[model samples]
Target chain A: MIRRLSQARERGIPEATVARLPLYLRALNGMAERGLATVSSEDLAVAAGVNSAKLRKDLSHLGSYGTRGVGYDVEYLIYQISRELGLTQDWAVAIVGVGNLGRALANYGGFVSRGFRVAALLDADPEVVGDHIAGLSVEHIDELEAVIRRRGVSIVVLATPAAAAQQVADRVIAAGVTSILNFAPVVLAVPEGVDIRKVDLSIELQILAFHEQRKTDRMTGGPAMAEEWPEAVDL
Target chain B: MIRRLSQARERGIPEATVARLPLYLRALNGMAERGLATVSSEDLAVAAGVNSAKLRKDLSHLGSYGTRGVGYDVEYLIYQISRELGLTQDWAVAIVGVGNLGRALANYGGFVSRGFRVAALLDADPEVVGDHIAGLSVEHIDELEAVIRRRGVSIVVLATPAAAAQQVADRVIAAGVTSILNFAPVVLAVPEGVDIRKVDLSIELQILAFHEQRKTDRMTGGPAMAEEWPEAVDL
Candidate 1:
């Protein structure tokens, strides 16, 4: 089933487009749950916080999933988006680093709702190894390889601390995982054909801070902000 | 200083591009720290994990800051990016929810490096108030209003659990914060002009899991895989 979907993806869809499909799926599901059977591009766009044109363009890439007169059939759209995102298949995920963030991710309600299952929970510390988290018992990090093979887990989520992320990533990759969702701050160097997506909280915060700072700066007319040339600075 | 940058942003720069200025600034600073005086678009793009063309386009939105032949002056580029990001003025930030993630952000080096100062930490827990964390004392949630006014805090970082997130966000908005970095899973409703950026670790992980599932399905051509879809739910 998964192979067939990959073949479908290979038939032409870009990965970037695939990533946004779930967001669309979530919005459509919400509309369905609200008892709305059909939605126009405008309605879905507002709910998803995206531009209607972009949404329409994105859906167009998925091949006329919506009607010309009607916007979209909520249930049918949900299934189509799910299929495009490759969410119509089961995926067993292994999570490393059962710390606060790790545990939070494991316990996150969104993960279970989107079609992914947490097959294994792992921690390096012996103290946390025997602990039960989100209905799954935390396993020792040493058992990662065996568990990955046993569960046939292909995707790994790294919620480890910055210092340990790379090491954990290395071990996970060595265990035969092909895709990684990194929550740690540092970058992970993956071999060709492997996919890595990073979610750095600090980085996101910094980006927001930058904009916030700019907004505040504009409100205050201070001369110290004289035009400066663009130059790289050492941290 | 911040005002000028904000005006510049309003003039024409895309909000998405504006958000990346701080990242470029940080990367430039890192390069400078290593004694680098100049960097090409390619070099900086690699450090930033962005394509050279996209990086160039983002910078171009801020005006032609980079020289065609010389690439970009390290120090000059850093200054320009920092100024554009409004990092020249220190931003007083209030961190709500003194949980593990909050503590981690409080201790994070990125914030300090980019002109964001942790002005106050607040929590609803009575026992946590007055406790020292990372050199700052955690204050009671009741004091949020007073602290925001006294310190002129303009940005709030919501690291609270989902249950308390909306309440915290409401209070923060009422206290006059115009920009928020929400780490909570829930959607925050803010008045017009208030910016809210969310970082959902679980959502990101689930997106990766979706792709991982596709990979596995593609690898194994089994008929039973079609039945795996209904079981592969994400929270």
Candidate 2:
């Protein structure tokens, strides 16, 4: 048995930093696309919607402080960040759940590129299971384990309904997939070693709503304290 | 002249904290659904997948120090968080780009509730323009300004392809949309005082790939350190 597993936590790059790496990578790539050979930290920060100081700090974690006066070479930085983010190699991804969101995810052109491939699509609905999407056959949910193993899938995308998300997650975990991208509008309980990242549309909306509400509050004086609370919320 | 703008920055709630607030709110709402009247910081932390100490710190930012030992009242905390998150009011959202992802977002079930309504859907394609999705008729993107004004669309979701994203972002920002949730795989440059949040599918996969590669490295005595590096990434 292994003594200690070297996971992301042990790697020393903060989780927040890991999340922002892709942002910087995207910004650098954009510069590269525009034929810019080098980017100042300030310029890249403006592109990434971050400040120059924070951008420098985040890049430092990648072990590349970049030459101070010369700025960062767009292509070299892309390679280093891609290496750190494990985007230099290819990954086969299996997206389970073929509902509208699932279909959308499967059909999304941006889903497959730069070292990520949609290996297979699985859904519980009989009608959807037989359909072809984004060049992959929609396999039945019954073949969940088979498809995962056969495709050598290390990551599973859970787009199942809320009621089915947990069960699907449980099955995928049992099949030895440790990484999951969940789009279901429910919280999934997974084992300790597994990692799950969730994408909920309404949740994002709620966040935007909060800020918009703040704007309305400022315009009309402090969230209209005089108005009665909605009945749906029992205050 | 207008007064102080109520940007999230001015409120002193760090962007990181603002993001986690939604996570906590989701967890709290799940607890309320299960009829939990009160929750200790530890339990809530477990439910939200963060450490209790960090959870306490995040909650403390909300000016809510849930009663020690006695725990936090679930309904009241829900209200506080909901109010702070602006879920207490409805936000009309317009989605531009009626591609597969856009269609899915339009039909997404979890989207309509929680004070967020899908006000309109627009697309640049003439073939896609006249289509109906999620009970809203898809409109032409040329009418983007008209739709934003007439429908009171406070937030715009950009599901357009990478090339079109920046241009569409410019148009929407000019149309008076202050908030944007971008799904395109490109970095968009927005004017000052505008807020943009991005949700990228492949980027998430790339992050997961990093962690998965770590697991492989641990099991295989370190990533076959002998492989030739990929070619020079041209700028």
Candidate 3:
């Protein structure tokens, strides 16, 4: 992981680590808001739903910001983490698909307060291109590359359908964008240096289904122990 | 963590383990499809994007399924994980909120292949309540409890708006449902023994932004070494 971090530093932070930093930041902020001046590794770990050892090791890669005996100053740690995560600077972002999900993202307070700024909204349908959404006029998909380059966008949000996701990703990458947050279900293959993160709602539900099943299994008994008659299987 | 796992097992498998089981299954299935009969811990770990030791440890909880020298049989491991995850049993799931995202979930193919079966579609809006969605009629929210009971639904997917999620959750829980997969951004404070797992798309993006920021900082040679500029003070 450390090697991945160093490589990310030389090129960029590994997409995985980049994804987790906000979770840690949120936990630290919660501690700070609670009037806790300092927090032990264990305290932050629990709040972030991660292990303390891993937290300490992750923090170590950035720099020795925590006191050995006193733990970490919550405010200072927040600033450090924020700085490391580039929260100190604003990032211009473009949304490729101006669908319901895209509109929700635009109106979402979390993205606005954080480092990301939704610079433009684009869609393939010409009828919806000039439509006003979240106070911004939606642009045609033809303007994607131009708008991305003009705005100096480094991050692109792909909310398009599965069929259009790869095409949008290709255009976004061709426009010099390095990081992409994909909501499409398909597995995206990007260049070696580019970073792509997927957020699939169906996949998350399926994962939960797997766990909910286990819960039912344990309630009945072991896997081999069947209590009632099995219903017809569907697939 | 182990203690939490034990406690979770009392209810079912730990939510953490549940989340990873699909990932493991996906990797194992990939191996099987590739015509590989067996995979070592290291090989499986790489495919699953997890550490080899952690993979071995997680598998150990199931049983000593892997040989010390020969590793694990791909098809056998897939079956074991599937059974442990309750994928062997079909779970009837009701999606409450047939909006753009919910409609997408209802149509997704992943759920059918996995343990989940989208048995019902629901909406609070009168106009949409009777509309057809993915071959299922969108039932009114008033019929939620009846549908859940009739279907013997052990799992409920909350794709409702953030404002309505809690109310829906209350109704679902009152109907004896114990597991919830929440897509809304708000946190659901469930009663003990009830499992709630959240998947927030915006949160994932914020996390990615944080790390993307850090990468840019390192490449620019840290704040201290960067050239002094008037805008630096603002950051």
Clashing pairs in 2: A210-B85
TM-score of A-chain in each prediction? 0.86, 0.87, 0.82
lDDT of 1 at A190: 77
How far residue A126's Cα lies from its native spot in candidate 1, in Å, is 5.0
lDDT of 3 by residue, A1-235 (tens): 1223454243544555655667788777777878999999998887777789988878776667788898988998899778777778777888888766677667665556666678899999887889997789999999887787677677889888777998888878776666899987656767766778877665576676565655666686532222332232343
| lDDT digits (tens) for residues B65-153 of candidate 1 | 67778898899888777766666677778899887677767776544555678889999989889989779999999988778777777
Docking quality level of the chain pair in candidate 3: incorrect
Per-prediction DockQ: 0.24, 0.27, 0.17
* Model 1 chain B weakest 10-residue run by lDDT: B223-232
Better structure of 1 and 2 per lDDT: 2
TM-score of chain A of 1: 0.86
lDDT of 3 by residue, B105-193 (tens): 67655445666677788899998988876677899999998787777777789888877998999999988888898887655757777
| Native A-B interface contacts kept, per candidate | 0.29, 0.44, 0.23
Q: Pick the candidate with the highest TM-score.
A: 2
User: Each prediction's Cα RMSD?
Assistant: 7.6, 8.2, 9.0
Docking class of 1: acceptable
Task: Residues A1-235, candidate 2: write the lDDT tens digits.
Answer: 2223245324578777888888898888878989999889999898887889998888777765477788988998899898888888777789989888888888777687688788889988887877988888899989987776666777899988888999998888887778999998777887777888887777677667767676767786543231322112111
The number of clashing residue pairs in each candidate reads 36, 1, 1
